[model samples]
Target: MQPTVQPFFESVTGTVTYVVFRSGHPECAVIDPVLNYDPKAGRTSTTDAHRVVEFVRQHGLQVQWILETHAHADHLSAAQYLRHELGGAVAIGQHIRTVQSVFKTLFNLERGFRVDGSQFDHLFREGEKFSIGALAAKALYVPGHTPADTAYQIGDAVFVGDTLFMPDVGTARCDFPGGNARALYDSIRKLLALPGDTRLFMCHDYPPDGRKPEWETTVLAQREHNIHVHDGITEAQFVRMRETRDATLAMPVLMLPSIQVNIRAGEFPPVEENGQSYLKIPLNAL
Candidate 1:
């Protein structure tokens, strides 16, 4: 069955959150919704997520799930927030535990944070199949961008989080914790192995100046012309190229604050003795 997609653009975050519903059923799934967070002010808002909720309500859609392609390190997820409002479970790749384990030590977080990935409602394994509204989705463990990265294949659209970027912009950085250029090459190869007609829906896009951000493309197009990870590129060549490009890249603008919050399913760290939750910033730690 074909799916209907509603793309929600978060301007400041430059991320595309999609509301995907099976064509004949009113049941819907929300993918990678963003919770607006202002790190400078240490404040969080429900505006973006609420917009999605309002849309769901208006459409009389039964919220089936809040799907996260991976544990993000750039923006806060609205999964829990929407889960609370809509009574849907939050799900992510089972490998998210790898991310949780890595970041727990990196941030020197407290003992309370569980690395088993029990924090989310469900953790999907590679090749796992599930359904939303009559449409079936299979999880493809697409690591290398991050340890837990996944590509969700639903109907003709594949929700690829940070695995590939718009052609002109190239792909995501393999410099984040657990990211590997060599592994990324393998992941891209796996993605290209899909039906060439598969639609690729990326998690985020930072468009070049004078252009609007785009979140969707075709695997055929990527295979033929994705500048960085296209099909004819050798794995060693990809690693060399990816690393060189990453070296010149600055960290995600929201890296420090985003990771601390993201690993916790977008919830801010618990408020301390002073009654204010705190996020850690490691000096010269990248």
Candidate 2:
């Protein structure tokens, strides 16, 4: 059964959060939900998250899962908040433990932080099947945007987070820690290998030249038109282009803050002795 999906765009971070469910069914899953953040103020608010919550409530949807395609570096996750308000298991790829361990050292997080992928309610392995109401879903371990990126395949629609973007925009950057251009090319092949008509939903869209942001496209369109890796592009060609392009890019503005919070499934870092939660910014550590 094809799942019905609703997209909620958070423009500040250019993130697309999705609410997906089976037709005529109350059970649903929220994907990549965002929590609004004011970096200048060092504060987070749930206004964007509430919009999703409102939609679920208005539609009388039952949220069975709050899923993350990966630990995002562009925006804070609303998983914990949504799980609190909507009642669902917060889940991600089993490899999140790799992310947790890496960031645990990068951020020098307190000893209390666990690196076993225990922050999430469930850890999904590649090929694992689960149900969202009557809709059957499987997790595809499509890494390389980071070591933990995943794509959720629910029938014909695949929620590809930070994997492939719009045709003109190309694919995700591979310069982040643990990201590999070779691996990313292989992962994109896996995605493009899907049935030509399968719908591939993007997690973020950085529109160009007055174009409107889009979150959905087909496997065929990507194979034909994706500038970075079209049907004939070789693995060597993709890796070279990706590496060269990534070298010119800058680290995401919210990378530091987002990593810490996302590593904990969107929960803020523990309160400090000063009676306030703090996000550390390690000087000169990128």
Candidate 3:
């Protein structure tokens, strides 16, 4: 069955959150939900997440999974908040342990902090089969932008997380810790290998020129028009282009804060004796 997909665009971070479910079923999965953050104040709000909650409640849908495509750097995840409010298992790629370990050391997290991926209720393996109600789903390991990145295939639709953006925007940068441009190229090829009509949903979109934000495209469109990796683009060429482009890019504004929270499954760092949570910034450490 084709799942019904609803996208919510968070403009501040150019992140797109999706709610997917079967038409006649109540079970649904929420993917890459955003948690609002104000860097200046180190504050978090649920304005965006509430929109998801309202939609779910209005549709009488039960969230079966709160899924993370990867531990994102551009925006904080609303997985924890949505799980608390809607009651669902929070899940991510099983390899999130690698990402968690990297950030845990960088942030010098508390001694009790674990990097076993236990923070998430479920950890998906490559090609792992699961379901939201009767709608079938599978996890595809699409590491490039990050070691633990995953794209979820629900029926005929694939929620491609940061692997490919709109054709005009090209693709995601592979400059973060453990990111590999070659791996990204291979991953993109894997995605493009799907059926021509397969629907692809983006995790984020940065509209260029005056184009309005869009999050859905198809395998054929990308294979034909994707500026960076169109049909004739070789892996070597893509890697070189990716590395060159990544070198000129600045680190995302919310990288430090987002990583700390996301690695913990969207929960903030442990509160101090003063009852406050703090995110760290390691100077000169990129």
Compared with the true structure, what per-residue lDDT tens digits does model 3 show for residues 48-111? 9999999999999999999999999999999889998998999999999999899888888999
TM-score result, candidate 2: 0.99
> Which ten contiguous residues of candidate 2 have the minimum total lDDT?
1-10
Off by over 4 Å in 1: none
**Whole-model Cα lDDT of every candidate shown, in order:** 0.86, 0.94, 0.95
The worst-scoring run of ten residues by lDDT in candidate 1 lies at 258-267
**C-alpha TM-score for every candidate:** 0.96, 0.99, 0.99
Stretches of candidate 3 exceeding 4 Å from the true structure:
none
Q: Provide the global lDDT of candidate 2 against the true structure.
A: 0.94
- Model 1 Cα lDDT, one tens digit per residue, 43-156: 889999999999898888988888988877778888878988887878889988888898898889998999998888888988999999788888899889888888888899
| Model 3 CA lDDT for position 285 | 85
CA RMSD (A), model 2: 0.7
Worst 10 residues of 3 by lDDT: 100-109
